[model samples]
Target: DVVGLDGAWVNDFAKQGAIADLSALMTEHDYDDSQLASQVEVDGSTYMVPAVNFVYPLYTNDALLADAGVDAPPSNRTEFADAARAITEAGDAAGTAMPLSLETPSGVQNQVMSWLWASGGSMLKDGKPDLTNDGVTETIEYFDDLYQDGVFAPGAFTMKEQDMVEEFTNGRVGMMVDSLAHLTMIRESNPDLKFSISALPAEDGYDGKRGIPYASWGLGVSESSDHKEEAWKLFEFLMSEDANAELASMAKAFPGNVASVPDFVEDDELMSQAFDIYQAGYPANEFTGLPVAEDLMRQMNEQFQAMLEGDITVDDMLETTQESWSAEF
Candidate 1:
C-alpha cells in the first residue's frame, strides 16, 4: 500500500482545495507530541499523527581531523575552515574535500537559517517576519564566502540525505549535517571512530549569537487520515518521555522536547567547551520553529544558491528574497 502522502502531494492538494479531512471516518485516538506533526492545525484541531521524529545534527570525521593534525573539534568558523583546509591540503582526499556537507533539503535550509540567527538576524519581531535587518545580509555574505571559496562539496546542491551521510561514513567528506537518526548506522559501520555532537557553530566572534537549528524533526498528525484514532495512540506514545528518550538514545540525535533527553546519551562537550554556545543553547528558542511568518525555507535555499554562485548579486539576492517572501510572510 502506498501512503501517497508527502509535501508534493500536499501542495498539489492545497492548490486544488481538494484535500479532505478523514478524522471523522476514524474513531477518536490519542497520540503524544511525537505524533503531533502528522496532524496539523485545522479549524483549531489536530488531524493525523506521526510515528517518529527526525532531527538534523552534525557528524564529524574525527579520524580525518586527527590525520590533518587538528587537536579537537573546531571552535569557530575560522577553525572549521582550518581543519578542512588541513585535511584537503594533506592530500587525504583527492582534489575534493567537503568541509561541510549539508545533506537533507530541510537541513540545508536550517543551516542557512542558523547563520541568520547566529549573526543577530531578526527573523521575527513582535511575532511577525522582519527581514529588514542587517543579520540577513551578513549571513548571506558569509555563506557566499564559503561557497565561493570552494569549502563545500560541489555536489552539495543535489545531495540526498542518505547520500550525504554516506559521504562522511565512506571517508569522502570531512563533516556532514544530516539526520541524527543515522548515528546508529555510523556507529555500527565504524565502531572505533570518534564522533561528536553539539550545537552548530555560529559566525566567528559572534558571542551574542549561538547557532542552532531546533525543530529538527517533530511529529505532526495529518488532517486527512482516517486512522487518526489509532495514529494518535501511537503519536502520544512516541512523544512520551519514555519513547522520546529511547529514540534519542537509539538514534543518537538530540531530543525535541527540552525536558525529555535520554540518559544514555553523553554530555555535550561542545556546549561545555564554548560558553557562547552553551548560552545560546540555554536561550536557544529565541526564534524557534518555522513559524508561518518566517515562510517555508525552501526558497531560502534557492536564493542562497543563487547568491553564492554569482548567478545573482547580493543586492539581487536581497531583492529576490524580499519579493519571494513579501506576500506570503
Candidate 2:
C-alpha cells in the first residue's frame, strides 16, 4: 500500500520495518531522486520520497521596521536583536513572534532550531544528539538575552503557530520566521499589511551558506503491501518533473524536485525572493530522520521554557535536554 507521511516520521517507520525501502524500486524504474530537496534515509537505506517542501523564511513588517528606524533587514544576530528591541521600544508591537506552546512544540524545530541552523550551528554530531555543543550553547544564550530584553511577543509560552501568524498579520509583532506557504493566507488576511520575506539572520561574522529549515510532504510504500508495483507507478508519476511542479504550485511550496521550478515565482515577488534565498542556502532539518522527533522537540521546548522563566540556567537547560535526548538515542 502506498502512503503519504510527514518527512520527519519516515525514519521511525523505517526503523520499525513498517515502510518499504524505495531504493530498489526506484532503480528498477530508473527514477532519480538526486534532484529532490531531501531524501529520508535510515541506516543508509532510502525509505521515503519527498514530494514538496515548505520552507521557513524570515518575515518582517515593513512599516514596523521603518517606524523603528531600521533601514534594512538585519543580516546578523546582533543587528536582528538590536532591530527587534528597537521595534519593541518604538511602539506597542513586540520585536518578534515566538510560539513556544508544548502542545505544538515543533516551534523548537522551526524557529529555535532554524536560528542555530542559520548560522551553521548543529544540534547533532556524528548523527546523534549534541545539544550542548558550543553552537547550541550560543543559540540558547542568544534567545535568553532576547527574552530578558522582553523583545518577544507576549504569550510566547502559550502561543501556537497559527497564533504567531495572527500576531504578525494583525501588526502585533514586527517580525517572524515562518513558512513561505503562508504568503497567500497572510496577504488575503490583510490586503494592506506590508511585509517582506528574507533569509533568517545568521550569527555575527558567520559568512558561510545559511541553513534554511523546511517541512516536507513525503510518500512511501507499506512494508507488507501487495500492490508494490502499483504503488511504484504512482510514485513515478508524482515525482515526474511536470507533476512535481504542478503539485508544488498548487500547494504554494518549493518543488521536491530541484529541477522543477514553481509557477508562483514568476508572478509573486515574495515567492521569487524566497526562491533566491532557498537557492543560496541548504535545506536543514536535523530532526527529519530522527527517532521520536516530535518528542525530542517537546523535550527541548520544556527546557527552553524553563530557561526563559528563569527556573533553570542555560547550562542546566542544555544539560537536561542533552540527557533527555541521549536516552532516546
Point to the candidate with the largest lDDT: 2
Model 2, 1-329: lDDT tens digits are 88998866877898888999888787887777777777877767788877888999999999999999999888889999999999999999999988999999989999898999999889988878998889999999999999999999989999999999999999999999998878889999999999988899999999999999988888899999999999898887788789999999998888878788889999989899999998889888888878899999999999999999999999999999999999987
Worst 10 residues of 1 by lDDT: 94-103
Q: What's each prediction's TM-score? A: 0.65, 0.96
Q: What value of lDDT does candidate 1 attain over all alpha carbons? A: 0.52
lDDT of 1 at 303: 69
In model 2, the worst 10-residue window by lDDT is 29-38
Give RMSD (Å) of candidate 2 vs. truth: 1.4
What is the TM-score (0 to 1) of candidate 2? 0.96
> Against the unseen true structure, what C-alpha lDDT does each candidate score?
0.52, 0.90
- Residue 72 lDDT, candidate 2, scale 0-100: 86
